[model samples]
Target: MGIDLLTIHWIYLIFILLIIVFMICKKDTSLICILGIFVLGVVGTSDFSVAVMGVFNSFVFATEELMGTILIISVITGMSNILLISGINETMIYPFTKIIRTPSLAYWIIGILMMILSWFFWPSPAVALMGAVLLPIALKVGLPRIGVAMAMNLFGHGIALASDLIIQGAPKITADAAGIPVSDVVSASIPLNIVMGVVTTITAFYFLRKDMKNGTLFEEERAVEDIEDKDCIEKNKYKFSKGTRIFFAIVIPLFFAADIVIMYIKKLQGGDATALIGGTACFVLVMISVLTYREKGLEKITSHLIEGFQFGFKIFGAVIPIAAFFYLGDAAFGQIFGEVLPANSQGIVNDIGIALAKAVPINQGVAAITLTTVGAITGLDGSGFSGISLAGSIAKLFSMALGSGIATLTALGQIAAIWVGGGTIVPWAVIPVAAICGIDAFELARRNMKPVLIGLIVTTIVGMFLI
Candidate 1:
């Protein structure tokens, strides 16, 4: 495992170049990241046999590590879809619109509401709920599709998912790697989340205002885009009962409450948080199916599970290749791949981080800003969490080389990645929002571009000075 300086890692450089060029050419970041990993393995070993094994090994480890979390997310998401189809989700959101009276209020209200729901239930479920009920009201009140999408993105994915204060998934993952307390990560992330949230939200507002002033578009018409009920066929498939609605109203909260209580009890005894949540979600999935389809319990349960798996695989598959590439940088994964290399080996991503750390001599404050920018760039792939470990690793390197504040730098990077890559500012990420609002995802993204960009810049600057 001796570090070798003499051997030129040409393949590594070429692979990274290809990825950058592809990204520049507007190729999918997921594909480029995957190819980066494949090249990393092939170059590192110079043996097809070993390279093939490395790829498989990396995937196995990555899949195993992410499996529980992914499955939990999928099942809960499917349950949310069920809730929407049953109109329970809409009923839950119906009252909020009554309190929200104006476009501005709608924006903040929707944003904050999504943040709250996503904190416990996650963004995917939160999206379904918000889209079904709150969206229609917001649309009715002249909240633009861009505005609604921005609100959901900021609250659900950006603030809620990034902080992960309740679910603790994102923090747990980062804290485990950093060897820090989950509480520390959570505490640090809260303020950073606020910075990003405020910046993104305000930026979105600014863009909206600019467009409104220019008369380029009308805010009222944003939500007036075609409302296709094709996706709502499920609404007709299942009849909603007042009883069932009440049942769901009680059961959904109860299930989540039970999850929290169980998680707390387990944590008191130092148990696994992810496993607790995952197991609870699985149970909820099963119970919901039984309660909803009491007559054909087994068949209906199988159907729900199938649907859950479909969603799980769709999310997981989209990023598996990306994860595979990032996996190469972690020592745990390197060991799994049986790569007898030092942790600091010049893999494409690592090399870039190391080179930046060495060449850019700067103060801790500026270092933090630089790190955050790098994190944001990496997040362009649209999976915020995918880049956390990389950001963490890079922050550590920068801290060592440039005397940057380690915790502060890491926090900055984490926020940057989760905010941008987590889905708030990206068009590809607004798919569910577009699907629900009956608008083009590209247009939603375009509308968001200015505000999100401004917010990210503001947040990064603030993080540097304050963090």
Candidate 2:
């Protein structure tokens, strides 16, 4: 497991430099990752032939690993997009406006709704739906666009997508790496998620309320200020056919409940649960598209799939290279690249990580914090999945080296990765919500920064104890 010092120093230096440049310049991570792979491959293999293959191999591995998640995410998003065009998303939220009579109530109400929908449908689509429907109502009732964006980001992206309780994708990643059941990861993560969610939400509310009070100077004018998304309001006036409403309302929940029950009964965990969820999502996607489109189902099906792929690729294209570099820190992929280098040299990337851990000798507390910090940083690239992949790999490496619970470590890492990069803390991730609400993404992220940082710190501490 020991790495040659000569290779370690050079590889480590190069990785650090690339990372610094990436952070400072805000360049595309994919290019940075490709460069890392090429450099590492050349150094490791010392053969032009192997170095060339290494680049192709990096992309191949990323495609192989992420293709399914990307497909499911894209298709589901596309389906939701179709639902939006049909005004089903608006129909779904109209009822909430009545119950949520005030701005405060709207904040929590939208947060919970976004959380639920996000768990099933994901944040990208959920945000679109929420933005199209709830945002105007929220603003009308005195909720700032910033507040609306913050709620969607925290609830949909941070709480729901991070947990991915219904979909099981995030849990599967951690569970697979830990060689544990998905159920165990799910069960453990729920409590952690609740703690994180409540703390973050309350903290956010406090800050938001104060801002609202201070900004009261323009209360009358702002109150009259229309969000200009009059088109969404017009769309909501259309009534959903009773059958469509009744069918989806009952069917969606029932499908998810069945999955939960089946998973519990079978004690299914990891890939089993993920396959079950993925399979169910695909079935539902097909059935729903068929039911809505009817005789034209074939073409509609193709359209939905195409939409899904476009959305998925848009997300994946941005994050894949970062994943490739992080994979270097793992023995599995690292060993593949390491073989290309000096025959006698050990995997430099893996070795350097271990050596640094040993050299600094961080305690479990500090290690947890470090892991969380690293996950948050990677999320800056804006695709939560890439950050999760990188964080999971790091967790596996550290857990093995430290003889800790990989499941716990991976879950902790997943939380940090998603919460930060998943959308709340990143301007790019908040763009949809911001654009839809006619607000600024940077301001949205800045508004969310404090709550998210606090939540991360608290969660990291809790993870140390739980793990």
Candidate 3:
């Protein structure tokens, strides 16, 4: 059965399209997102005051949802800053520098390592940890920070997350909704994942090399690129023994390595894993501050933490408005603004996905395309996982009617969802990477767009044949 699309749904869709157009035109979408939220508020409640308040509440909602990631990034950045000020980061990255002597080596090495770690710890936490270690090495080897970001994002969130073999979170959701075994989805995803990962990463690399060669890639917008750019030692203002530097360098990785072990044995994923890493970063930051600064440690630790948070909030401040508006298109709308969706509706984005699926006829080719389109639409909510069940449900309907290709269709939908919303093309979704790389999130998203779009098209066509 097809669900009725409400006025709010149309409003949300129009704004989403507008946001995409604005993004393509390289315009900031914060005002557009704020207007979208206010319009949603007005359409839902029919009250001017409530509409204005909705924008504020939506910001609060996005912050609450994003707090964990923000905290982790802050502490990590704080720890990074202290390491920079103390000169520990140079020692920490010395080994990696030997191995990553060239830009090509740096790109592939960081990417592969990120993929392996993300398979275990998931992308968000893994990135926080990996960026602290590998970023300097990549930067030193002439790989741009955006290049490093692209490598990690592509290999981690785009590939490992889409496949999700270790965690099985994404496939489990889609498999259950599609009425298939998780193994079926996993098995079907292997080839498609390889295609998407290889094609997208290679395509992205090609552009990176071309622009870098032509001197077109820009990183100069920032006052400083990263930790390494500044004098590694402010020796006049701060002093630490070489032993202390070496000690923390060893301790830092050991502690984070222990975190990975604990995560493995405990079967922690998502927020739990993120909390584990964040807590470790906090502990390390305190230890370094106290041990390095001695009498002034108490005061210095708070200052370092303040700097970290300032940096985290700075990046996220620009993002909350956009994230707030997208969160409304998902289950968060009811929680934030009250139960205003129509009786037959399945939330705003889900309704749109179902409507799109219903408008199409059932066949193998149409099924593949519809599943991909539905998955991408659902992913527009930007959680990546939010509306995938709808994709699975629609895939099941088409596959059963066509009498084959359920697994292929299901996997196809999962890929499209994660690729678009997990961390690739969505600017807000890729904000953490942009923050870490110190690049504009919109520009990062734009760099990712062409390669990802091309990869999706090729992968969807491949799935059609498999179906």
Q: Which of the predicted structures, 1 or 2, would earn the higher lDDT when compared with the native?
A: 2
List the global CA lDDT of all models: 0.66, 0.71, 0.76
Ranked by TM-score from best down, the candidates are: 2, 1, 3
| Per-model TM against the reference | 0.82, 0.85, 0.64
Candidate 1, run of 10 with poorest lDDT: 1-10
lDDT of 1 at 175: 53
Across residues 1-467, which tens digit of lDDT does each residue of candidate 1 receive? Answer: 23342232344445545644553353666666655666566556666776667667777776776676676666666666566666677666766779887888988999898998887678876776677667767877777766787788777887788777765656654553443455666776667777777777777777676776787757663344334454377566674787778777777777778867876766621126656665666676676666666687568667767877887677666456655555555454456445456555654334544666678766766677776776676566676766565566556556556644566667777777777777765667768877776678888777666666676677667767654
- Candidate 3, 157-197: lDDT as tens digits: 89988997655667766765566777788889999999999
Return model 2's CA RMSD, one decimal.
3.8
- What's the lDDT for residue 74 in model 2? 75
Please estimate how well model 2 matches the true structure, expressed as its whole-model Cα lDDT: 0.71
Best by lDDT: 3
Candidate 3 ranges beyond 4 A from true positions: 1-5, 99-228, 231-239, 342-344, 362-467
Model 2 poorest 10 in a row by lDDT: 217-226
lDDT of model 1 at position 14: 59
Candidate 3 Cα deviation (angstroms), residue 221: 27
